[model samples]
Target: MDGTLLTPPKRSARARGAVLGALMLGAFTFNTAENLPIGLLDVVAGRLGVSVPATGLLVTGYGLTVAVASLPLTHAVRSVPRRHVLTGVFAALAVSSLAAALLSSYGPLLAARLVTALAQALFWAVMGPVAVGLFPPGVRGRVIGALSVAGSLALVAGVPGGTWLGRHGGWPLPVTVAAVLGLVSLVTVAVLLPTTRPEAEPAALGISPDRRRFALVLTAGALSATGAFAGFTYLVPFLGDVGGFRPETIGVLLVAFGLACLAGVSLAGALLDRSPHGVLTGAVAVQATGLLGLYAWGARPAAAVLFLVLTGGALGPVFMATQHAMLHCAPGRTDLAFAANSGAYNVGIAAGAALGGLILPYAGVRAAFLAGGLLAVAACAVLLPGRPRPAES
Candidate 1:
């Protein structure tokens, strides 16, 4: 047996699961905090005495910070204890949430969002590799699948939950609750995560990558993200203004989409171990089809809901595929790979939201979906010809 396998097997499994669960909860809270403003946009806009476009600055600012911070933070903390770093990141997020909750003015709120974005960047930068490290190679996919499932549940639960809470108690209440959850996650990480370093030492896993391949993967990830979020960011308005669904009903539909994504992520992980590129290519195509279908048929409530669920399901494999590609591009540098991917994802969020905002003023929600479809198709074009084969660890 390997020396690293000396710990009690049952205790070890439970500890690893708990750590993953905690990380998932952190991911949930981070996303919830980031997106809560989306569902409550009108309310937030009115309260801050600003236009919807101004309020959107909150999202854009947060995304930009995350995009800029991921790589540097990953490099700076490469040798730190995983648990310690996780705890610190969550604690910072909790502080930012508290600031957002307490402040009533726009400037303070924007500043608070920037702080949360930094924490979120660090949190995601650590999660992928940490999830991989917690399990032996034989079960790596399953462990990551479980982590993805937890994140999916959060995506499904967080937005609607925060929206409902904000509706009932005001914007600050949901943010406060998110802060509390961050604290809880912090405690969970400190207690459950084992003390471990990266299997490949920091020096050995050189943080640099071939510039050409790096740029390609990064561009592909950003384009794919742009496609995914174009429709997603405007989902609530589309359901309400176009599809004639009530807010509560829209929430339910969003939850359903999230659950579908959870299922997709689980299935994708299993399939990815065998043929990652094929899975990713299929996912992108399916998502593009779903986005276009929504644009064409979204006026009907039932059709809109069904197509949204399909879109979410198709989205499930995209992340895994992107991560696989990044790691392959830089086989030894897991931290840098994840950081680059995380940055691309943030850029995607910013691009998609900005595009949606620009189009929603004149072209309507359908136009946003069309834009997303075009981006997805572009991503497919970039990714298909140069798909890298899986590298042996």
Candidate 2:
């Protein structure tokens, strides 16, 4: 009945699964690239001859670029074939990582990171839709769930692995490994991903239908992230100064925390689609409690590690809940909502690091946890009234 249907056999399930695996690897590679620096901040700063706080500006700047560029870059690439766009992003990231490895000075390294941030922004914006489109509707949820697992595993593997490599091999080793992963991801995508033309008009920036809900969701996201990252970005310092962890021991602890994060993601995925608001509120409450515990007992090694695990566990779920909330609240504007959410997330990252940097010298590391807990409480307050609306009668 249709020439197109008969033109060629569809890809086999095995082939499709391999493509999906490649996409997941892309997710893993990109996340690893972004998070690699987190574990190597001190090493990077020391090697580049900059103060640690000034080194923090690298994280701050990268997040700011992603927040600023996500929407626009996504719009620019909306009409491009998904395969080419994804492949290009991976290639760019590979090059950026290589530049970061080779650059001698802090300025050039920072510049290279900024370029990577641009590619990362577009990658996050488009990755979901492309992944979902590759599968039938009936299997989409599974595909996304698997992709999320890949992302969580990136944390499981990337951060600690990078830290270990950096400790033994030097700062460049971790980033260089990230570069290799990026290249592998690039080739996988190019060879495996089928070209898919845009199915609808590109998502654009516009006023959300429910302004109050949108504002609340955005604020909640920003506040929660600020709370988490304030302490998280400085976690290595906290572990050394407060928890009394040796450099090698810190890597093991980070891996433990990453495992908790994976569990949190799994739990959130199970719960969020049912009640986004409840899950978000509960996550914030738990996180706040954990941060407060860390603040009070961080001087004790066991207590600090316990609280760290709890805090890490809650982080993933909060992100999942925020994404779920944004999608549910915005009726026809999922794209705009996602973009706003992404921006809020990164803005919170910058804000948290800046806030922690300011406070670390003045008040102390414990105070950072206290401040972060208060921010989480603030997020809870904003989200209290933001239960998803009842279905239309």
Candidate 3:
């Protein structure tokens, strides 16, 4: 038997559910920590005696750390049991969150966030393979989608809730809550999850062995994400400038978008395993259509929100499907492949924002949406031509 296949312990339904719950909780905790600064930016800046623009670096710095460190850190812990590595990462995140809350000073807080960023980068890199190992292959798409739901929930509830709490209770309150949740997740994982080892199997039954094909998947993902972010990053301004939405209305719209994202992932969970390529193709088309709609009809308030919903719904599933595709295509090196995916995602985000900024100066915000639409169309072109053959074991 190859080292790639490990038989997971046959556990009861309740036990399996507990394990999945713990993993999801861990996902929620880390995602909340990553986005907490977005909520506390003004408060943190005021308390730390810095400009709000300077505090924005907190988000950028964390993204850079995750993008740079994901592959190397995952490689470093390649030989460790996934259970142990995850537990350690959660513990570190908890500690870092607590430190950031207590220190409150800008420099110390930034340092603490960077610490958590390292853990987050590594966590995302390995979580896909870990989820696959714990569940049956037939339900892989569902498991991955469920896990991705945690992230969507974080965006929908965590950030807004944290901001509200910070506004009422104080900035430190949110970080402290995140730290406590991280600890709870750490305890849950340590107690509930079984120790699992990596399989030495060549690859999964339907995966492709061609490295170039794997690279294509990554490229497509990057393009799709770039297209999404180009308009998404400037959505608030677009709504205000074009649609004439008030501040409160825009906040409601953001929540609506998040809910659409949740719905999107739920649907993808059911369909992805049966037809990975088809799902990707459909998602890309939907995203392109939504963006183009926004470009053409954004001046109308109702149409703008409608297209926003469409875009969010399609955009939400792309992450999970892409991750599933990567893990499926390279089951033998799931961690490494996912690390690359994580990096690609971050790069796409940065690139899309940069491109949008350039377009914003020369063209109006609507033109940026058109640019994003073109990129999404290009992404679809890349994936529609070839079917990735299932690799031989």
lDDT of 2: 0.75
Model 3, 1-393: lDDT tens digits are: 332244446777777677678778878888888878887888989989999989988988898888889989988988787778888988998999889889858888899999999999998987777766666666778888899898888888888899899889888899889889888878877887667554432222225445766777788889988999899989999999988999999999999999998899889888988887788788889999999999999999889989999999998788788888875565347788888889888888878888898899889899889999999999988887656775221
lDDT of 2 by residue, 170-280 (tens): 888888887887888788788877775543322222212456777887898899999988988788898899888899999788888889888877776666545556778
Give me the displacement of residue 255 in model 2, in angstroms: 2.9
Whole-model Cα lDDT per candidate?
Answer: 0.77, 0.75, 0.82
Query: TM-score order of candidates, best first?
Result: 3, 1, 2
Better of 1 and 3 by lDDT: 3
Ranking by lDDT: 3, 1, 2
Total clashes for model 1: 0
Report clashes for each candidate as comma-separated counts.
0, 0, 7
**What's the alpha carbon RMSD for model 2?**
5.0
The better candidate by TM-score, 1 or 2, is 1
Q: Best candidate per lDDT, number?
A: 3
Give every collision pair in model 3.
3-199, 3-200, 4-199, 4-200, 4-201, 5-199, 207-391
After superposing candidate 3 on the true structure, give the runs of residues whose Cα lies further than 4 Å from its correct spot: 1-6, 200-206, 390-393
Q: Which ten residues in a row have the lowest lDDT in candidate 1?
A: 1-10
Model 1 per-residue lDDT tens digits across residues 312-337:
99876687667655544554466667
